[model samples]
Target: MTKKTLAFVVYPGISLLEFVGSRTLLGIILAQEGSPLKLGVDYELVVVGERIEEIPTDTPLSILPQKTFADVARPDALVVIGGGADTLLALEDTNLISYVRGAGECASWVAATSTGSLLLAAAGLLEGRLATTHWAYADRLQAYNVRYQATETSNTVTDGKFTTTAGASGAVDMALHLGAQLTNQATAQFGQLMIEYDPHPPFGRLDWTSFDQQRAILTPLMNRRPDRQDTVQDIAFLLYPGLTVFDLVGPLQVFSALHRIAPEFRLIVVAEQAGPVMTDIGVRMVPNCTFADLPHPDVFFVPGGTTPTLQAMSNPAIRQYIRSAAQHAQWIISVCTGALLLAAVGLLEGREVTTHWSFPRYLKDLGARYVQKRWTVNGNIVSAAGVSAGVDMALYLVSRLRNEETAHTVQWLIQYDPQPPFGGIDYQHLKLLPRCMRGIFTFVAPLYTTKARRLTRQERGRPPYDV
Candidate 1:
């Protein structure tokens, strides 16, 4: 069978969540176990950029596209991602709009996520079509002669050939729907399961009573661009293959907003070597620099993963770097099981820390005091409970570093207001499960330790494990 190509348009200052979430779901077919579908065989996924150069995102991390607009002019499916002010700026780029218009016109499927629908409208593709975008910008669609749909209840809206989504989180829902259309419901469901797409927001559903009030307050701030400050403080994030993207992206997004308002706060992602690192999801991320490039930073950040994180605990080089970096960093932060990595390096000894609810015993075994909270701070060390908790912790960190007003501004910019479809986790009911899970980790620890030790002796040319 001839491979059908799906091209995702990427640009400067694009929202990472919208791009990553949609791409991860759509591309999961390649990673589905026992599936006949294969990359370059049944399907192909390409990141289409205006140029092949590294493009900055709304977050501190930048992305390197696999192809340029000139290289892949038209794909089977075209997905245009969105952003904040940068997206508004993208509408003015004649070259970009031309490419989107031409490619979108020819593609079998055309889709936009978050504010990306605005780009489709700018490209003159959504005229007389029903569309939706991030609620903040819903009113802007009518200017281009497009009928705007309220995304308050539905994350996605499809009008003929065009598919538009509400917010960054809606990208996942849109991708699943599109995936089902292109392949089968079974394929989409399998992909969703692979990524564990269950939604459980810590807070209850969002109240839409004040949509106009929020729109009025945030519209001007979205348009306002603060002058860059000369004074700088380096904030570094550690990157590794098989790590959870949300663990890093959640905090990174928060800090990115901080950087937007206060240029003095510089954000950087570092790895053992600089290049593409495949995430826990099927998506790939390219770090900004190498660990050796920035040995010491004002703030040192670490993200967590599943089995890979356990294996990382045994890597001597990683352990050494963390120990050395922690000595010099003014603040040390970990999200989810990243606390286990810090604990592995002996930096969390006697310190009150929190990690993913499932891994508190591991932290305690590694000689750290476990605190059951969304996030905890002890001296210069800070840790968050799990993946989503990183955002909450990061917002608090911003308040500490700058002020509550500054943090609040960043919160509003990202629409951090939580409105989970289902209420927060009921820990009381699951109390017995944690006790059972704690014992399982004891046996799981030594197995990964042995695997890591074996990996250390292997040739350095190959990756530690398949991402």
Candidate 2:
């Protein structure tokens, strides 16, 4: 097999996380067993900068280049790291830009992260395509007249051969997309799977029953399942439980917010069980599930979490009960892991969907596509990842149910503004950043509040960036 070369080009004031984030993705993809891009086989990570001596890393540690931009062979993929506000011009050195111009002609993919796109734009890499960066530098980056729209979606933009990310976290999505392009879906899946895509709530999580796929596995609890019809105007979650604090609050609240602005389409938030739900931050909420017991509503909503109670709902009988209720419900919607329960009941087979990235394993184990995207709408079904993401997805859903005018208003209300105060790009790895900007805007932000993984002996000392 022809070996693939990945050249990570670094410069002064580079955002360290974006730089390391790119390499980490390529590293993770190669680390998986039997993956097409195996360690020591398909790819090699090369950090290239201008200096002949050791370079300063974005973090406190120092970084050494595998090769200099003035010397390395042309690569299959060329990645430019994000730089600081002032470094955009500092990185405008002719030697590096010359190499990039040549790579632009030879490399299969040209990727940039954060303000790194500014480098490419400076080198004339993004002449005609839409590009983005951290919203702050975005003003400066766009000063060059590049079309810069404020988009809060996931990364990996492909314009012919150029790819760019919005900001720091987007680097992961960009690299994964590049991985998919270099390899294949299954190869990409292999790497994603090795990252433990199967999600079990720290509390535990699940997927589906069996065929008679669409057949009911049990009796409906009330008048709702009396049996079918309606193409599905919209699906609203009408429950107090099974919602992640964010999803439970964000999606429903945002959807309601949209209605408050414009009332073209109808919305319903129902519940099978009634009570108060404590959100992720301890916020309390009382739901409107009375319809779940009345005439079967056209749309169905399953909230996230419900982790503590998912086991009870996992039964075939309960699955059948939900299946029967859904028989009349036009669309089934779940935000985050709530989609898994829908899948477990056989409602999401072969359907395009999404749940939070954190719930990858749950999405994968159920054979659901836990895409890094916010929302994936398949006919009759729509699912969203995380609670915050649910707002994005729901707004999209609201647009489809209502209109673009309404969606635009909702987007503005939420301030869908994403200029991170401390961009995470600087915290990724030592090798990726220039020493100049260390500690200014650190990525890999402090850590998740809770311990993400419980590593076994086999995993001891192994890198945990995958978590």
Candidate 3:
């Protein structure tokens, strides 16, 4: 098979999820270690735009293009992104439309997601093709002599070499389809499993009839972020063996919420390798990017797990990556005992931080001033107390990065208002528990540190490879 160049056409105010999700899913398939085909060997990936510059999106984040229209005169497959309705309507670049038409002539497959299909329509490539845009833009999609089709279960419509998908989530499905076309169904299935793409919503499907309720819930977030000049921050979350899922995902949920509103923040989950890493509780998480891929991040985040974190400190590569990334990072944040990793790398030296209540003394031993607060911030270093506290820290970070208004908007969207069934965490309430239950808590409390210490001591006398 011939080597193909997969290109993404990026623009200002484009939907980050639509663009990133498709590319990431495809990347996972291409870059899956041990696969017969490799990224640079079997295929080349490129992000193209009108110019080779950073394009700001509707969210707080900005995307950097790898190639310009002049550079990538033709690509085997191209992805044109879609954005807000008004933003898409305002985009009337003759040069861009002309390039799209010219590129489509030689491209084997031309695809668009959401309003991005409109660009293809505007370029006259969709004149006789059957396509689909976001459901809201179905009528407008027909204006270019394209047949607009909709289905309840599926979101993609493909005709010949042209494929268009509805909404942001449809990007994944479309990418999966493309993956199979590029490689094989088995490889695509493996990619899906690596990312754990199975969706299981807790509250079930939304009622389409309840338009008023749905509109009230979605309107604030659906509106385009007002234009502003800001820098994009690349945030990297460190993942390793035996990590606690909630420790990483807690703050991530908050950040993901903020990302929808203000995308100035980009989150990249990084690990030693490119594939799945198992957590302390046996849950597996696949890191989308690797340490080498994203070396210098603006924000370096670590989530704590007891056994793995201690083991991670002994690994020279983990220590080196954290140290190197820290040199360029504007902020270093941690959740739970993740503070230990930062401390291990000497980034937390003499800094005021916090950790899980069970390990405050351990944090103090590492030269950090342990404060018993929901979260602690000293200069550019921030630490959250245990797993649940990550959300508070993330919300606070959002406020610092953008504004209280933006943070509040994210908070409202996620419905962060807490109404815990057990009246929330309190040291006093612990004494009220039954003696039998207290025994169990006591047994579990020191398990993490004890196991970690054992591993550390065992490696003390041995050479690096003796393990």
Judging by lDDT against the true structure, name the best candidate. Answer: 1
| lDDT of each residue in 87-161, candidate 1, tens digit only | 988988999999999999999889998889999999999999999887778778788999998766777789999
Cα lDDT, all candidates:
0.76, 0.53, 0.67
Order by lDDT, highest first = 1, 3, 2
**How does each model score on TM-score?**
0.76, 0.42, 0.54
Query: Measured by TM-score, how close is model 3 to the native structure?
Result: 0.54
Q: Write the per-residue lDDT of candidate 3 for residues 1-467, one digit (tens) a residue.
A: 45888778877777655665577677767765545565334667778888865576544334467778988988887888787554454358787788788888789889997778888999889998888876556677898888997634466788999998876556767777777777676677655543334332223222345544644655666554544437777888887878765567656656766776767777788888876676543324467677888888899778886657756655667766776787678888988888877776566768888876556655555556878677788888888876656766787888888887666656544433332211233443333223344355346544444443444455444433210
**Residue-wise lDDT of candidate 2 within 223-242, one digit each (tens)?**
12112334324445544443
Q: What is the lDDT of residue 34 in candidate 3?
A: 47
Off by over 4 Å in 2: 31-33, 36-41, 189-467
The model with the greatest TM-score is 1
Alpha-carbon runs more than 4 Å astray in model 3: 31-41, 86-90, 209-221, 224-467
- Model 3 C-alpha RMSD to native: 13.1
